[model samples]
Target: MSVLVYTENWDGKFKKLSFELVSYAGKLAEMLGTTVTAVSIGSVDQAELQKLGNYGAQKILHVTGPNLDKLDNQVFSSMIVQAASKEDASVVLLSNNNSGKAIAPRISVKLNAGLVSAVIKLPVSLNPFTVVKKVFSGKAFTNVVIKTDTRVLTLSQNSFELIETGNKATIENFNPEIDTGLFKTSVKDVEKVTGKILLTDAEIVVSGGRGMKSPDNWGPIEELADILGAATACSRPVSDEGWRPHGEHTGQTGKIIAPDLYIACGISGAIQHLAGISSSKYIVAINTDKDAPIFEAADYGIVGDALKVLPELIEAVKEVKSS
Candidate 1:
């Protein structure tokens, strides 16, 4: 039995989630008494795949071509299926991010495998493998057993603990045949967010909401984030009002984050917003309205105006960092 993890890259470099997924796949490999292999398809070089040894991948299979750079559902799913077939992978892992969400199900259909998305916990085996996962928009969890030839899983970001033990492995390059006709999507300009990490993968998040009053009032939020080495996020209303980018929005309809600490400033917690961040390890809520629903989900709640509270928080964070 072999476990294969699909690694995504950016600008010919391995993304952070690549190691995370490979580390998770290594655990599955240990359980199955097999080796962990990684499959990467993009413009990345074989050297990038070779570096996956740091994450315990025994072998890396890379397929690169001009058509592989852009996201083509048909071409990517086909290539992944080909890799799984070649590797004879029993369990296939992918990160439950944008790319994973799009490709995992398609690959599952191609492989006729059972899939578990948003996987939180590792497999529990009494007899068959039982994987626990979030369901109903993270309202509850259910255990699923993959009683099939292949088990496909997409691990949720920040769900599993990343383990590091230096193990450098060999990387092999294999080029797959891509029918240029199948490449429907074209590579265009890529836009990137600057000065902040993605909230989903961030360890700490400093979020602002309507309490900031205006976009200009977000200075303290950025300062606090910089001091704490955290990402900046916003509530739905703030994004709707165009005070912040939509990508920084965190709510049910927005990005869900499970950071170690989530500090919500000036945002009255609505059920919609709480649904996105309720999985965070610890929550700190600050608002002038004591009755705000956000306080219910917070580990610590402070009833005060955000305009007054933010400056103090920023100053305190800077002081601690300097000390």
Candidate 2:
């Protein structure tokens, strides 16, 4: 049996999470004395598929069809199940992103595999197949043992580092049987924000909150993010107040991000917001109130007006870059 990884692609390129999944699965395969087989859906260049070998994919199954270009959760899960069965995979790994969240549960039920979502580390014990996962919105960690013949795991994004093995993967064409009825719902149009780093993949993130006062005052936060080559994010209330897009929201109810450095500007640091960012390697909090909850969780605390401090911070960053 092999360790199978589902490598999802977007805009003809493999996402950072895809490479991480392959690398992670390869390690698991080595532990199990097996190989790693990668599965890809939709159209991607063969050269791109082969690059997965560098991340430990021994072989790749590319499933391409006319209707597979658009993401239909039902259709995608069916393809994954078929691919896993074909590969005789004992462990199946997927990134716990939007797409994975949509399809992992369905695939687990279809394969009758014990499934774990947001796994942070490799299995502590393989005999019982116990894995550590984040629980209570990143507040705690729990070790779960899967007592099943087959197992499925959805890894948390940015949890693992990708290591290249300088190997090439053998690509094969896989055509799975599909029911056209699954295509009843079709995507009409898609709009994506351009020219900004995605928060999930960002190494550093600069976030703003209600203390920024208004949406109009977001200029300094954006500037700071640009200076640091970081992504921009917002607290949940900022998005709910219509000051920021929902996609940028980070809290217990929103996206969970684990960046290297997270700078919170004008944020009070509610428990829910802290839950989302608690995994950050280093947290810097800039707030007017020293008692703000965010300071309690911050590695560095700056008690000042964000509007005044942000501009100076941006200029300092610019000077450092120039020097």
Which prediction has the highest TM-score against the true structure? 2
Q: Report the poorest 10 consecutive residues by lDDT, candidate 1.
A: 42-51
Assess candidate 1 and give its lDDT: 0.86
Candidate 2 structure quality by residue, lDDT tens digits, 63-166: 88787777898999988999999999999899999899989999999999999999998899999999999899887899999989899999998899998999
lDDT of 2: 0.92
Clashing pairs in 1: none
RMSD (CA, angstroms), candidate 2:
1.1
lDDT of 1 by residue, 1-323 (tens): 68989998877898667888888988889878999988888767656777688887988887877666678888888888888888899888999999999999999998999998988867987248789987766778888988887989999888777777688777777676668788787767888776667787789999999998999998888888887889999999999999999989998999998999999999998888988998899999999999999999999998999889888888887788788
Q: CA lDDT of 261 in candidate 2?
A: 97
Lowest summed lDDT over 10 consecutive residues: which window, candidate 2? 177-186
Error of 2 at 82 (Å): 0.8
Q: What C-alpha root-mean-square deviation, in Å, does candidate 1 show against the real structure?
A: 1.7
